[model samples]
Target: MPNIPRNALRSLTLLVIWEMWKERNARVFRQYGRPATEIVDSIKGEALLWIKAGDTALANLLVRE
Candidate 1:
């Protein structure tokens, strides 16, 4: 899974779920939609943001992967 700590992975999971829920609501309420690539990009960007908020080594490792 990317060799991250359990807590880090959990944080990432929660962030992804929250982001997905937000996107779902946006699609339903605002008729907004996004492509798969965009969604993946968003997730990756946010994951990096969360990672950056903590350790730089972890972020660099993830980016390398």
Candidate 2:
């Protein structure tokens, strides 16, 4: 929680929740599941998409120091 903007934090929280939900559904319905590392990678990839879509607050929060 590195002093991220509220919007950025909200976006991240929702992203995590959505991903977890999808994983749960996949496991329960499709008998498929991904490792936690893969889930984190998916989140990173999706964050890049958000950045491309002009979410500067998210971009700032994600940037390496």
Candidate 3:
């Protein structure tokens, strides 16, 4: 989160929490399981998707410096 703004941090936190919760429910209800690295990658992918969908400037900051 270094060099990222506070709002980005908050959004990232919520995204991560929601992803983890959803994965947890899947594991419990669907007997699904995945590696931790895969989950982390999914969370990163989701954050990128949401950022691109919501804020182009932020998306650029994330990807293009």
Candidate 4:
């Protein structure tokens, strides 16, 4: 595999974490003002739809059982 620079990898990881944090905040503070269940459900539904639309890899990963 090709080598990725440390800074680049760190930046990518930070971006992902920031995105997750933002989603959590939106779900907990803005939309439902409670636990993240609703937000998680929405993400699941979106993932399922995306899988049905041909993203087999993501769909497989998201499926629970």
Candidate 5:
């Protein structure tokens, strides 16, 4: 696989983390009034669902292991 620059990877990681944080904060602030722990749990659950969906798609493709 091609290499990624350390700084570029770090920046991308930070951007993803920030986006997730903002999304959780917005959802809690607007509708749920939930605590930080609960908000993080919700984000985790959502991410799990996304992973499951992707896994399902790849399985359907039957790509070589």
Candidate 6:
């Protein structure tokens, strides 16, 4: 990896895992599925929420020039 800050990496990892778990639950319980692009978009949106909710590390990583 290339100079990833620890907290941002941890937050991103947990977010991805959580999103995957959610997708799994949706598929298993509700028979719902989304495309990979939708999932990636969801991740991006959720990351913004995380930043707004006080994840400075993620904000730092995401808010780039």
Candidate 4: global Cα-lDDT?
Answer: 0.55
By descending lDDT, how would the candidates be arranged? 6, 2, 3, 1, 4, 5
Stretches of model 6 off by over 4 angstroms after superposition: none
Best by TM-score: 6
- Alpha-carbon RMSD of each model: 2.7, 1.5, 2.4, 7.6, 8.2, 1.2
Misplaced by over 4 Å in model 4 are 32-65
**Model 3 root-mean-square deviation:** 2.4
Q: What Cα-based lDDT does every candidate model obtain?
A: 0.77, 0.86, 0.79, 0.55, 0.53, 0.92
Weakest ten-residue segment in model 5 by summed lDDT: 56-65
Runs of candidate 1 exceeding 4 Å displacement: 1-4, 55-64
What are the TM-scores, per candidate, against the unseen true structure? 0.71, 0.86, 0.75, 0.44, 0.44, 0.92
Better of 2 and 5 by lDDT: 2
Reference-based TM-score, model 2: 0.86
lDDT of 5 at 60: 31
Candidate 2: the clashing residue pairs are none
1-65 in candidate 1: lDDT tens per residue?
76677665667677779789989998999999898789889988888777768855546556666
Which residue pairs in candidate 3 collide? none
Select the stronger candidate by TM-score from 3 and 4. 3
- Per-residue lDDT over 1-65 for candidate 3, one digit per residue giving the tens place of the 0 to 100 score: 57777766677678889999999999999999889999999988887888868855456557745
Instruction: Please give the distance, in angstroms, between residue 60's alpha carbon in candidate 1 and its true position after superposition.
Output: 7.6
Pairs with steric clashes in candidate 4: none
Worst 10 residues of 2 by lDDT: 56-65
Worst 10 residues of 3 by lDDT: 55-64
Q: Tens-digit lDDT track for model 2 on 1-65?
A: 66668887888888889889988999999999999999999988888898899988878888844
Model 5: CA > 4 A from native: 32-65
